[model samples]
Target: MTAADTFETILEMRARAVEDLLGSLLDERILPGEIARPARLLQAMRHGVLNGGKRLRPFLVVESAGLFGADQDAALRVAAALECVHCYSLIHDDLPAMDDDDLRRGQPTVHKAYDEATAILAGDSLLTLAFDILADEATAIAADRRAALVLALARAAGAGGMAGGQALDLDAERTQPDEAGIITLQAMKTGALIRFACEAGAIVAGAPAADRERLAEFGSAIGLAFQLADDLLDLTSDTTTLGKTAGKDVAAGKATLVQLHGPDWTRRQLDGLVLQARELLKPYGAAASTLKLAANFVATRRK
Candidate 1:
Protein backbone atom coordinates (compact mmCIF):
# COMPACT_ATOMS: atom_id res chain seq x y z
CA MET A 1 0.00 0.00 0.00
CA THR A 2 0.98 3.59 -0.52
CA ALA A 3 1.81 5.68 2.55
CA ALA A 4 -1.67 7.20 2.69
CA ASP A 5 -3.32 3.84 2.23
CA THR A 6 -1.12 2.32 4.90
CA PHE A 7 -2.05 5.02 7.31
CA GLU A 8 -5.76 4.61 6.63
CA THR A 9 -5.45 0.88 7.10
CA ILE A 10 -3.59 1.26 10.37
CA LEU A 11 -6.10 3.80 11.58
CA GLU A 12 -8.98 1.47 10.76
CA MET A 13 -7.28 -1.44 12.51
CA ARG A 14 -6.52 0.63 15.58
CA ALA A 15 -10.07 1.94 15.71
CA ARG A 16 -11.44 -1.58 15.56
CA ALA A 17 -9.07 -2.64 18.31
CA VAL A 18 -10.23 0.20 20.56
CA GLU A 19 -13.89 -0.58 19.85
CA ASP A 20 -13.44 -4.22 20.72
CA LEU A 21 -11.67 -3.42 23.95
CA LEU A 22 -14.32 -0.92 24.99
CA GLY A 23 -17.08 -3.28 23.96
CA SER A 24 -15.66 -6.01 26.15
CA LEU A 25 -15.82 -3.73 29.14
CA LEU A 26 -19.33 -2.49 28.39
CA ASP A 27 -20.71 -5.90 27.51
CA GLU A 28 -19.42 -7.66 30.59
CA ARG A 29 -21.96 -8.53 33.25
CA ILE A 30 -22.08 -6.64 36.50
CA LEU A 31 -22.78 -8.91 39.46
CA PRO A 32 -26.35 -8.65 40.63
CA GLY A 33 -27.11 -7.04 44.01
CA GLU A 34 -23.62 -5.63 44.34
CA ILE A 35 -24.84 -2.15 45.12
CA ALA A 36 -28.27 -0.60 45.43
CA ARG A 37 -29.48 0.47 41.97
CA PRO A 38 -26.13 -0.41 40.48
CA ALA A 39 -27.63 -0.58 37.04
CA ARG A 40 -28.09 3.17 36.82
CA LEU A 41 -24.48 3.86 37.62
CA LEU A 42 -23.40 1.06 35.33
CA GLN A 43 -25.47 2.48 32.52
CA ALA A 44 -24.10 5.94 33.08
CA MET A 45 -20.56 4.63 33.14
CA ARG A 46 -21.14 2.71 29.94
CA HIS A 47 -22.68 5.72 28.32
CA GLY A 48 -19.61 7.81 28.92
CA VAL A 49 -17.07 5.09 28.17
CA LEU A 50 -18.83 3.69 25.14
CA ASN A 51 -19.65 7.02 23.62
CA GLY A 52 -18.17 7.71 20.21
CA GLY A 53 -14.73 9.25 20.63
CA LYS A 54 -11.64 9.49 18.50
CA ARG A 55 -9.91 6.85 20.69
CA LEU A 56 -6.62 8.53 19.98
CA ARG A 57 -5.06 7.69 23.32
CA PRO A 58 -5.71 3.99 23.04
CA PHE A 59 -4.54 3.96 19.46
CA LEU A 60 -1.26 5.52 20.48
CA VAL A 61 -0.77 2.91 23.16
CA VAL A 62 -1.35 0.07 20.74
CA GLU A 63 0.82 1.58 18.04
CA SER A 64 3.68 2.13 20.46
CA ALA A 65 3.43 -1.47 21.55
CA GLY A 66 3.60 -2.57 17.95
CA LEU A 67 6.90 -0.77 17.58
CA PHE A 68 8.36 -3.11 20.17
CA GLY A 69 6.85 -6.27 18.62
CA ALA A 70 4.50 -6.83 21.51
CA ASP A 71 1.28 -8.78 21.37
CA GLN A 72 -1.59 -6.65 20.11
CA ASP A 73 -4.08 -8.17 22.56
CA ALA A 74 -1.99 -7.32 25.58
CA ALA A 75 -1.39 -3.84 24.26
CA LEU A 76 -5.13 -3.38 23.80
CA ARG A 77 -5.83 -4.04 27.47
CA VAL A 78 -3.49 -1.20 28.38
CA ALA A 79 -5.17 0.97 25.79
CA ALA A 80 -8.58 0.20 27.26
CA ALA A 81 -7.42 1.23 30.71
CA LEU A 82 -6.11 4.49 29.31
CA GLU A 83 -9.39 5.19 27.56
CA CYS A 84 -11.35 4.52 30.72
CA VAL A 85 -9.31 7.10 32.57
CA HIS A 86 -9.70 9.57 29.71
CA CYS A 87 -13.45 9.13 29.46
CA TYR A 88 -13.79 9.61 33.18
CA SER A 89 -11.87 12.87 32.97
CA LEU A 90 -14.11 14.09 30.19
CA ILE A 91 -17.24 13.18 32.10
CA HIS A 92 -16.14 15.18 35.10
CA ASP A 93 -14.81 18.04 33.01
CA ASP A 94 -18.22 18.56 31.41
CA LEU A 95 -20.04 18.87 34.71
CA PRO A 96 -21.88 22.09 35.63
CA ALA A 97 -19.25 23.14 38.12
CA MET A 98 -16.47 22.49 35.66
CA ASP A 99 -16.52 23.37 32.00
CA ASP A 100 -20.31 23.00 32.06
CA ASP A 101 -20.39 21.63 28.57
CA ASP A 102 -23.59 20.14 27.23
CA LEU A 103 -22.12 18.24 24.33
CA ARG A 104 -19.36 15.69 23.82
CA ARG A 105 -18.34 13.53 20.88
CA GLY A 106 -21.35 14.89 18.99
CA GLN A 107 -23.75 13.77 21.71
CA PRO A 108 -25.14 15.08 24.97
CA THR A 109 -22.62 15.40 27.72
CA VAL A 110 -22.92 12.95 30.61
CA HIS A 111 -24.39 15.57 32.89
CA LYS A 112 -26.90 16.57 30.24
CA ALA A 113 -27.98 13.01 29.50
CA TYR A 114 -28.03 12.07 33.16
CA ASP A 115 -27.92 14.07 36.39
CA GLU A 116 -24.78 15.79 37.58
CA ALA A 117 -24.50 13.47 40.56
CA THR A 118 -24.75 10.43 38.36
CA ALA A 119 -22.17 11.91 36.03
CA ILE A 120 -19.76 12.45 38.90
CA LEU A 121 -20.24 8.92 40.16
CA ALA A 122 -19.86 7.57 36.67
CA GLY A 123 -16.58 9.37 36.24
CA ASP A 124 -15.36 8.12 39.56
CA SER A 125 -16.34 4.57 38.73
CA LEU A 126 -14.62 4.72 35.39
CA LEU A 127 -11.43 6.00 37.00
CA THR A 128 -11.42 3.20 39.55
CA LEU A 129 -12.34 0.63 36.96
CA ALA A 130 -9.38 1.67 34.85
CA PHE A 131 -6.96 0.55 37.53
CA ASP A 132 -9.07 -2.52 38.19
CA ILE A 133 -8.90 -3.52 34.56
CA LEU A 134 -5.18 -2.93 34.38
CA ALA A 135 -4.68 -5.18 37.36
CA ASP A 136 -7.13 -7.79 36.15
CA GLU A 137 -6.32 -11.11 34.53
CA ALA A 138 -6.55 -9.70 31.04
CA THR A 139 -3.08 -8.19 31.20
CA ALA A 140 -0.60 -10.79 29.98
CA ILE A 141 2.56 -8.81 30.44
CA ALA A 142 5.26 -9.66 32.95
CA ALA A 143 4.54 -8.81 36.57
CA ASP A 144 7.33 -6.27 36.85
CA ARG A 145 6.29 -4.51 33.68
CA ARG A 146 2.65 -4.55 34.71
CA ALA A 147 3.57 -2.91 37.99
CA ALA A 148 5.53 -0.24 36.14
CA LEU A 149 2.61 0.32 33.81
CA VAL A 150 0.28 0.88 36.74
CA LEU A 151 2.68 3.33 38.36
CA ALA A 152 3.17 5.20 35.12
CA LEU A 153 -0.58 5.51 34.62
CA ALA A 154 -1.16 6.63 38.19
CA ARG A 155 1.49 9.33 37.97
CA ALA A 156 0.10 10.57 34.69
CA ALA A 157 -3.52 10.65 35.86
CA GLY A 158 -2.96 11.72 39.43
CA ALA A 159 -2.24 14.95 41.28
CA GLY A 160 1.14 15.58 39.68
CA GLY A 161 -0.03 15.37 36.09
CA MET A 162 -3.45 15.51 34.46
CA ALA A 163 -5.32 16.38 37.64
CA GLY A 164 -2.76 18.97 38.65
CA GLY A 165 -2.88 20.46 35.19
CA GLN A 166 -6.67 20.70 35.39
CA ALA A 167 -6.44 22.40 38.75
CA LEU A 168 -4.02 24.86 37.24
CA ASP A 169 -6.37 25.43 34.34
CA LEU A 170 -9.23 26.25 36.70
CA ASP A 171 -7.02 28.64 38.57
CA ALA A 172 -5.85 30.21 35.34
CA GLU A 173 -9.43 30.82 34.30
CA ARG A 174 -10.00 33.21 37.20
CA THR A 175 -6.94 35.26 36.28
CA GLN A 176 -6.93 34.56 32.54
CA PRO A 177 -3.37 33.35 32.20
CA ASP A 178 -0.81 34.39 29.63
CA GLU A 179 0.33 32.25 26.66
CA ALA A 180 3.15 30.42 28.48
CA GLY A 181 0.84 29.62 31.36
CA ILE A 182 -1.76 28.25 29.00
CA ILE A 183 0.75 25.99 27.26
CA THR A 184 2.08 24.75 30.57
CA LEU A 185 -1.43 24.01 31.74
CA GLN A 186 -2.30 22.10 28.60
CA ALA A 187 1.01 20.21 28.67
CA MET A 188 0.03 18.71 31.96
CA LYS A 189 -3.77 18.56 31.67
CA THR A 190 -3.74 17.09 28.17
CA GLY A 191 -0.20 15.94 27.54
CA ALA A 192 0.19 13.75 30.60
CA LEU A 193 -2.25 11.07 29.52
CA ILE A 194 -0.94 11.04 25.99
CA ARG A 195 2.57 10.55 27.30
CA PHE A 196 1.32 7.82 29.57
CA ALA A 197 -0.34 6.08 26.64
CA CYS A 198 2.97 5.89 24.80
CA GLU A 199 4.95 5.01 27.87
CA ALA A 200 2.52 2.31 28.95
CA GLY A 201 2.83 0.68 25.57
CA ALA A 202 6.57 0.73 25.80
CA ILE A 203 6.48 -0.72 29.26
CA VAL A 204 4.24 -3.54 28.13
CA ALA A 205 6.54 -4.24 25.21
CA GLY A 206 9.62 -4.37 27.43
CA ALA A 207 11.33 -1.80 25.27
CA PRO A 208 14.86 -0.79 26.17
CA ALA A 209 15.54 2.36 28.15
CA ALA A 210 16.69 4.32 25.13
CA ASP A 211 13.65 3.35 23.05
CA ARG A 212 11.38 4.17 25.92
CA GLU A 213 12.88 7.61 26.31
CA ARG A 214 12.53 8.24 22.60
CA LEU A 215 8.89 7.21 22.63
CA ALA A 216 8.31 9.44 25.63
CA GLU A 217 9.73 12.39 23.73
CA PHE A 218 7.61 11.46 20.75
CA GLY A 219 4.56 11.32 22.96
CA SER A 220 5.24 14.65 24.66
CA ALA A 221 5.78 16.44 21.36
CA ILE A 222 2.66 14.98 19.81
CA GLY A 223 0.69 15.72 22.95
CA LEU A 224 1.59 19.40 22.63
CA ALA A 225 0.75 19.25 18.95
CA PHE A 226 -2.61 17.72 19.75
CA GLN A 227 -3.41 20.54 22.18
CA LEU A 228 -2.32 23.18 19.69
CA ALA A 229 -4.55 21.63 17.07
CA ASP A 230 -7.46 21.65 19.48
CA ASP A 231 -6.84 25.33 20.20
CA LEU A 232 -6.74 26.10 16.50
CA LEU A 233 -9.86 24.10 15.81
CA ASP A 234 -11.64 25.87 18.61
CA LEU A 235 -11.02 29.05 16.68
CA THR A 236 -11.56 27.95 13.06
CA SER A 237 -14.03 25.09 13.31
CA ASP A 238 -17.75 25.21 14.08
CA THR A 239 -19.66 23.29 16.71
CA THR A 240 -21.25 21.00 14.13
CA THR A 241 -17.93 19.64 12.93
CA LEU A 242 -16.17 19.63 16.29
CA GLY A 243 -18.93 17.59 17.95
CA LYS A 244 -18.68 19.89 20.98
CA THR A 245 -19.47 23.44 21.94
CA ALA A 246 -17.40 25.66 19.72
CA GLY A 247 -16.20 29.14 20.66
CA LYS A 248 -16.65 28.21 24.28
CA ASP A 249 -12.93 28.56 24.88
CA VAL A 250 -12.92 32.10 23.62
CA ALA A 251 -16.16 32.88 25.40
CA ALA A 252 -14.71 31.54 28.62
CA GLY A 253 -11.91 34.08 28.30
CA LYS A 254 -9.38 31.29 28.41
CA ALA A 255 -5.92 31.99 27.05
CA THR A 256 -5.10 29.83 24.05
CA LEU A 257 -2.35 29.67 21.43
CA VAL A 258 -4.62 31.47 19.01
CA GLN A 259 -5.25 34.22 21.53
CA LEU A 260 -1.51 34.51 22.20
CA HIS A 261 0.31 33.99 18.93
CA GLY A 262 -2.61 34.19 16.50
CA PRO A 263 -3.84 31.35 14.26
CA ASP A 264 -1.02 31.47 11.73
CA TRP A 265 1.70 31.29 14.31
CA THR A 266 -0.13 28.54 16.16
CA ARG A 267 -0.32 26.53 12.99
CA ARG A 268 3.37 27.03 12.47
CA GLN A 269 4.08 25.84 15.99
CA LEU A 270 1.98 22.76 15.34
CA ASP A 271 4.00 21.96 12.22
CA GLY A 272 7.21 22.33 14.17
CA LEU A 273 5.98 20.04 16.90
CA VAL A 274 4.89 17.43 14.41
CA LEU A 275 8.34 17.52 12.85
CA GLN A 276 9.94 17.08 16.25
CA ALA A 277 7.72 14.08 17.01
CA ARG A 278 8.49 12.42 13.69
CA GLU A 279 12.23 12.83 14.28
CA LEU A 280 11.95 11.15 17.67
CA LEU A 281 10.40 8.08 16.01
CA LYS A 282 13.02 7.82 13.29
CA PRO A 283 14.87 4.99 15.03
CA TYR A 284 11.87 2.70 14.64
CA GLY A 285 12.42 2.66 10.85
CA ALA A 286 9.45 1.29 8.89
CA ALA A 287 7.41 0.61 12.03
CA ALA A 288 7.39 4.32 12.76
CA SER A 289 5.10 5.23 9.88
CA THR A 290 1.97 4.92 11.95
CA LEU A 291 3.45 7.20 14.59
CA LYS A 292 4.44 9.74 11.99
CA LEU A 293 1.01 9.65 10.41
CA ALA A 294 -0.67 10.02 13.77
CA ALA A 295 1.48 13.07 14.56
CA ASN A 296 0.64 14.58 11.20
CA PHE A 297 -3.03 13.86 11.68
CA VAL A 298 -2.99 15.52 15.10
CA ALA A 299 -1.33 18.64 13.75
CA THR A 300 -3.51 18.92 10.65
CA ARG A 301 -6.86 17.60 11.84
CA ARG A 302 -9.78 20.02 11.45
CA LYS A 303 -11.76 18.52 14.33
Candidate 2:
Protein backbone atom coordinates (compact mmCIF):
# COMPACT_ATOMS: atom_id res chain seq x y z
CA MET A 1 0.00 0.00 0.00
CA THR A 2 1.00 3.60 -0.48
CA ALA A 3 2.54 5.49 2.44
CA ALA A 4 -0.43 7.91 2.58
CA ASP A 5 -2.84 5.02 2.88
CA THR A 6 -0.58 3.43 5.47
CA PHE A 7 -0.59 6.64 7.45
CA GLU A 8 -4.39 6.66 7.55
CA THR A 9 -4.64 2.98 8.49
CA ILE A 10 -1.98 3.22 11.21
CA LEU A 11 -3.54 6.39 12.56
CA GLU A 12 -6.93 4.69 12.87
CA MET A 13 -5.33 1.67 14.55
CA ARG A 14 -3.34 3.76 17.03
CA ALA A 15 -6.34 5.95 17.91
CA ARG A 16 -8.35 2.83 18.70
CA ALA A 17 -5.45 1.44 20.71
CA VAL A 18 -5.32 4.68 22.71
CA GLU A 19 -9.04 4.49 23.40
CA ASP A 20 -8.76 0.91 24.66
CA LEU A 21 -5.79 1.64 26.91
CA LEU A 22 -7.35 4.78 28.28
CA GLY A 23 -10.56 2.91 29.10
CA SER A 24 -8.74 0.20 31.05
CA LEU A 25 -6.35 2.59 32.72
CA LEU A 26 -9.22 4.70 34.03
CA ASP A 27 -10.72 1.62 35.64
CA GLU A 28 -7.54 0.49 37.47
CA ARG A 29 -6.47 3.59 39.35
CA ILE A 30 -6.69 3.14 43.12
CA LEU A 31 -6.81 5.82 45.76
CA PRO A 32 -5.76 5.71 49.38
CA GLY A 33 -8.81 4.79 51.53
CA GLU A 34 -11.06 5.08 48.52
CA ILE A 35 -12.53 1.78 47.45
CA ALA A 36 -14.34 2.79 44.28
CA ARG A 37 -13.58 5.08 41.40
CA PRO A 38 -15.30 8.46 41.54
CA ALA A 39 -17.88 7.77 38.91
CA ARG A 40 -18.63 11.35 37.86
CA LEU A 41 -15.00 12.34 37.54
CA LEU A 42 -14.17 9.14 35.72
CA GLN A 43 -17.10 9.66 33.40
CA ALA A 44 -16.11 13.22 32.71
CA MET A 45 -12.55 12.19 31.98
CA ARG A 46 -13.90 9.48 29.73
CA HIS A 47 -16.17 11.96 28.03
CA GLY A 48 -13.22 14.23 27.39
CA VAL A 49 -10.83 11.56 26.14
CA LEU A 50 -12.92 8.79 24.60
CA ASN A 51 -14.89 10.88 22.15
CA GLY A 52 -12.94 9.37 19.21
CA GLY A 53 -10.51 11.53 17.22
CA LYS A 54 -7.31 11.28 15.19
CA ARG A 55 -4.94 10.86 18.18
CA LEU A 56 -2.27 12.66 16.17
CA ARG A 57 0.15 13.26 19.02
CA PRO A 58 0.31 9.56 19.80
CA PHE A 59 0.76 8.80 16.09
CA LEU A 60 3.76 11.12 16.02
CA VAL A 61 5.25 9.44 19.10
CA VAL A 62 4.85 5.97 17.67
CA GLU A 63 6.21 6.93 14.25
CA SER A 64 9.12 8.94 15.60
CA ALA A 65 10.09 6.22 18.08
CA GLY A 66 9.64 3.60 15.39
CA LEU A 67 12.29 5.44 13.40
CA PHE A 68 14.82 4.66 16.12
CA GLY A 69 13.87 0.96 16.45
CA ALA A 70 12.31 1.64 19.84
CA ASP A 71 10.13 -1.03 21.44
CA GLN A 72 6.60 -0.56 20.15
CA ASP A 73 4.91 -1.46 23.44
CA ALA A 74 6.98 1.02 25.43
CA ALA A 75 6.41 3.72 22.84
CA LEU A 76 2.67 3.08 23.01
CA ARG A 77 2.68 3.63 26.76
CA VAL A 78 4.53 6.91 26.34
CA ALA A 79 2.07 7.91 23.63
CA ALA A 80 -0.82 7.19 25.99
CA ALA A 81 0.78 9.38 28.63
CA LEU A 82 1.14 12.25 26.16
CA GLU A 83 -2.50 11.75 25.17
CA CYS A 84 -3.64 12.16 28.76
CA VAL A 85 -2.14 15.63 28.81
CA HIS A 86 -3.67 16.46 25.45
CA CYS A 87 -7.11 15.34 26.60
CA TYR A 88 -6.82 17.19 29.87
CA SER A 89 -6.03 20.40 28.04
CA LEU A 90 -9.04 19.87 25.79
CA ILE A 91 -11.35 19.38 28.77
CA HIS A 92 -10.19 22.55 30.41
CA ASP A 93 -10.17 24.46 27.14
CA ASP A 94 -13.86 23.77 26.78
CA LEU A 95 -14.75 24.89 30.25
CA PRO A 96 -17.11 27.84 30.78
CA ALA A 97 -14.20 30.06 31.70
CA MET A 98 -11.98 29.14 28.78
CA ASP A 99 -13.26 28.68 25.28
CA ASP A 100 -16.78 28.24 26.66
CA ASP A 101 -17.59 25.60 24.11
CA ASP A 102 -20.43 23.14 24.50
CA LEU A 103 -19.08 20.49 22.15
CA ARG A 104 -15.82 18.66 21.54
CA ARG A 105 -15.04 15.76 19.23
CA GLY A 106 -18.72 15.98 18.22
CA GLN A 107 -20.03 15.23 21.72
CA PRO A 108 -20.93 17.27 24.76
CA THR A 109 -17.77 18.72 26.24
CA VAL A 110 -16.73 17.63 29.73
CA HIS A 111 -18.36 20.56 31.45
CA LYS A 112 -21.54 20.22 29.44
CA ALA A 113 -21.63 16.45 29.81
CA TYR A 114 -21.11 16.67 33.56
CA ASP A 115 -20.60 20.07 35.23
CA GLU A 116 -17.96 22.77 35.53
CA ALA A 117 -16.54 21.54 38.83
CA THR A 118 -16.39 17.98 37.57
CA ALA A 119 -14.73 19.14 34.41
CA ILE A 120 -12.04 20.94 36.41
CA LEU A 121 -11.41 17.86 38.55
CA ALA A 122 -11.38 15.60 35.53
CA GLY A 123 -8.82 17.75 33.81
CA ASP A 124 -6.78 17.82 37.00
CA SER A 125 -6.93 14.05 37.29
CA LEU A 126 -5.82 13.41 33.70
CA LEU A 127 -2.98 15.90 33.97
CA THR A 128 -1.59 14.18 37.06
CA LEU A 129 -2.30 10.72 35.71
CA ALA A 130 -0.03 11.47 32.77
CA PHE A 131 2.89 11.88 35.15
CA ASP A 132 1.77 8.83 37.07
CA ILE A 133 1.87 6.78 33.88
CA LEU A 134 5.29 8.12 33.03
CA ALA A 135 6.57 7.15 36.49
CA ASP A 136 5.27 3.62 36.23
CA GLU A 137 7.75 0.89 35.30
CA ALA A 138 5.53 -0.49 32.54
CA THR A 139 6.82 2.28 30.29
CA ALA A 140 10.16 0.31 30.35
CA ILE A 141 12.45 3.29 29.95
CA ALA A 142 15.25 3.97 32.46
CA ALA A 143 14.75 6.48 35.29
CA ASP A 144 16.74 9.20 33.55
CA ARG A 145 14.76 8.76 30.38
CA ARG A 146 11.53 9.04 32.32
CA ALA A 147 12.87 12.12 34.07
CA ALA A 148 13.67 13.75 30.74
CA LEU A 149 10.22 12.86 29.50
CA VAL A 150 8.64 14.38 32.58
CA LEU A 151 10.67 17.55 32.24
CA ALA A 152 9.89 17.86 28.57
CA LEU A 153 6.19 17.23 29.13
CA ALA A 154 6.13 19.73 31.96
CA ARG A 155 7.71 22.54 29.93
CA ALA A 156 5.44 21.81 27.01
CA ALA A 157 2.31 21.80 29.17
CA GLY A 158 3.27 24.58 31.54
CA ALA A 159 3.70 28.32 31.27
CA GLY A 160 6.53 28.19 28.76
CA GLY A 161 4.39 26.15 26.40
CA MET A 162 0.69 25.43 25.94
CA ALA A 163 -0.52 27.33 28.96
CA GLY A 164 1.48 30.41 28.06
CA GLY A 165 0.34 30.26 24.49
CA GLN A 166 -3.26 29.97 25.62
CA ALA A 167 -2.88 33.02 27.81
CA LEU A 168 -1.51 34.93 24.84
CA ASP A 169 -4.40 33.71 22.73
CA LEU A 170 -6.91 35.05 25.24
CA ASP A 171 -5.13 38.38 25.28
CA ALA A 172 -5.00 38.59 21.51
CA GLU A 173 -8.76 38.99 21.45
CA ARG A 174 -8.24 42.34 23.14
CA THR A 175 -5.18 43.50 21.18
CA GLN A 176 -3.75 42.57 17.83
CA PRO A 177 -0.57 40.47 17.86
CA ASP A 178 2.19 41.02 15.36
CA GLU A 179 2.96 38.16 13.00
CA ALA A 180 5.98 37.10 15.06
CA GLY A 181 3.95 37.14 18.25
CA ILE A 182 1.24 35.11 16.57
CA ILE A 183 3.83 32.55 15.42
CA THR A 184 5.37 32.26 18.88
CA LEU A 185 1.97 31.88 20.48
CA GLN A 186 0.98 29.17 18.02
CA ALA A 187 4.32 27.38 18.52
CA MET A 188 3.87 27.21 22.26
CA LYS A 189 0.13 26.54 22.40
CA THR A 190 -0.03 23.93 19.64
CA GLY A 191 3.52 22.97 18.64
CA ALA A 192 5.24 22.29 21.97
CA LEU A 193 3.63 18.93 22.68
CA ILE A 194 3.95 17.93 19.04
CA ARG A 195 7.67 18.65 19.25
CA PHE A 196 7.76 16.49 22.37
CA ALA A 197 5.92 13.70 20.55
CA CYS A 198 8.67 13.50 17.92
CA GLU A 199 11.48 13.98 20.42
CA ALA A 200 10.11 11.41 22.88
CA GLY A 201 10.64 8.58 20.37
CA ALA A 202 14.35 9.31 20.18
CA ILE A 203 14.54 9.59 23.93
CA VAL A 204 12.82 6.22 24.33
CA ALA A 205 15.22 4.51 21.91
CA GLY A 206 18.28 6.39 23.14
CA ALA A 207 18.92 7.53 19.59
CA PRO A 208 21.73 9.96 18.84
CA ALA A 209 21.10 13.58 19.86
CA ALA A 210 21.33 14.66 16.24
CA ASP A 211 18.51 12.37 15.19
CA ARG A 212 16.33 13.55 18.03
CA GLU A 213 16.90 17.18 17.08
CA ARG A 214 16.00 16.51 13.47
CA LEU A 215 12.74 14.77 14.37
CA ALA A 216 11.96 17.51 16.87
CA GLU A 217 12.48 20.06 14.11
CA PHE A 218 10.17 18.08 11.85
CA GLY A 219 7.53 18.08 14.57
CA SER A 220 7.86 21.82 15.08
CA ALA A 221 7.48 22.45 11.38
CA ILE A 222 4.35 20.31 11.07
CA GLY A 223 2.92 21.77 14.23
CA LEU A 224 2.93 25.12 12.46
CA ALA A 225 1.32 23.60 9.42
CA PHE A 226 -1.29 21.92 11.60
CA GLN A 227 -2.33 25.19 13.22
CA LEU A 228 -2.32 27.06 9.95
CA ALA A 229 -4.45 24.39 8.37
CA ASP A 230 -6.77 24.54 11.37
CA ASP A 231 -7.09 28.29 11.05
CA LEU A 232 -7.85 27.94 7.38
CA LEU A 233 -10.46 25.33 8.16
CA ASP A 234 -12.09 27.67 10.64
CA LEU A 235 -12.23 30.27 7.93
CA THR A 236 -13.52 27.98 5.21
CA SER A 237 -15.37 25.04 6.77
CA ASP A 238 -18.66 24.81 8.63
CA THR A 239 -19.22 23.51 12.18
CA THR A 240 -20.71 20.20 11.09
CA THR A 241 -17.57 19.19 9.23
CA LEU A 242 -15.19 20.53 11.89
CA GLY A 243 -16.98 18.73 14.76
CA LYS A 244 -16.72 21.95 16.77
CA THR A 245 -18.03 25.46 16.46
CA ALA A 246 -16.63 27.01 13.29
CA GLY A 247 -15.99 30.74 12.72
CA LYS A 248 -15.47 31.04 16.47
CA ASP A 249 -11.94 32.24 15.93
CA VAL A 250 -13.10 35.06 13.75
CA ALA A 251 -15.93 35.85 16.10
CA ALA A 252 -13.54 35.89 19.02
CA GLY A 253 -11.23 38.23 17.13
CA LYS A 254 -8.30 35.92 17.77
CA ALA A 255 -5.07 36.79 16.00
CA THR A 256 -4.15 33.96 13.65
CA LEU A 257 -1.53 33.75 10.91
CA VAL A 258 -4.42 33.36 8.51
CA GLN A 259 -5.84 36.58 9.84
CA LEU A 260 -2.53 38.30 9.11
CA HIS A 261 -1.73 36.67 5.75
CA GLY A 262 -5.11 35.69 4.14
CA PRO A 263 -6.12 32.25 2.80
CA ASP A 264 -4.07 32.02 -0.41
CA TRP A 265 -0.87 33.19 1.25
CA THR A 266 -1.41 30.87 4.26
CA ARG A 267 -2.02 27.87 2.01
CA ARG A 268 1.19 28.56 0.09
CA GLN A 269 3.11 28.93 3.35
CA LEU A 270 1.65 25.64 4.58
CA ASP A 271 2.99 23.89 1.48
CA GLY A 272 6.48 25.24 2.12
CA LEU A 273 6.34 24.28 5.80
CA VAL A 274 5.22 20.77 4.94
CA LEU A 275 8.11 20.42 2.50
CA GLN A 276 10.58 21.70 5.09
CA ALA A 277 9.27 19.21 7.64
CA ARG A 278 9.58 16.31 5.20
CA GLU A 279 13.10 17.31 4.13
CA LEU A 280 14.40 16.92 7.67
CA LEU A 281 13.84 13.16 7.33
CA LYS A 282 15.59 12.82 3.93
CA PRO A 283 18.70 11.19 5.38
CA TYR A 284 16.59 8.29 6.71
CA GLY A 285 15.11 7.66 3.20
CA ALA A 286 12.26 5.11 3.12
CA ALA A 287 12.17 4.83 6.90
CA ALA A 288 10.96 8.42 7.06
CA SER A 289 8.21 8.04 4.46
CA THR A 290 5.53 7.64 7.10
CA LEU A 291 6.65 10.83 8.78
CA LYS A 292 6.77 12.67 5.47
CA LEU A 293 3.25 11.46 4.80
CA ALA A 294 2.29 12.74 8.25
CA ALA A 295 3.47 16.23 7.30
CA ASN A 296 1.42 16.10 4.13
CA PHE A 297 -1.61 14.98 6.08
CA VAL A 298 -1.27 17.82 8.54
CA ALA A 299 -1.03 20.39 5.77
CA THR A 300 -3.95 19.08 3.76
CA ARG A 301 -6.51 17.58 6.16
CA ARG A 302 -9.96 19.18 5.69
CA LYS A 303 -10.79 19.05 9.37
The top-ranked prediction according to TM-score is 2
- Which residue pairs of candidate 2 clash? none
* Model 1 stretches with alpha carbons more than 4 Å out: 1-6, 28-37
Give the TM-score (vs. native) of candidate 1: 0.93
Give the per-residue Cα lDDT of candidate 1 at 52. 63
Question: Across residues 1-303, which tens digit of lDDT does each residue of candidate 1 receive?
Answer: 777577767777787778777777766465343344377788888889887667889989999999999988889989999999999999999998988888776688888898999999999988987887787666888888878888889999999899989999898778787767787789889999999888877898999988888888889999999888888888889988986667878887788878788899988898899889998888889887888999998888877
C-alpha local distance difference test of each model? 0.86, 0.88
Q: Which pairs in model 1 have colliding backbones?
A: none
Error of 1 at 216 (Å): 0.9
Candidate 2: where are CA atoms >4 Å away? Answer: 1-3, 29-36
Reference-based TM-score of each model: 0.93, 0.95
Ten contiguous residues with the weakest lDDT in model 1: 28-37
Q: Top model by lDDT, which number?
A: 2
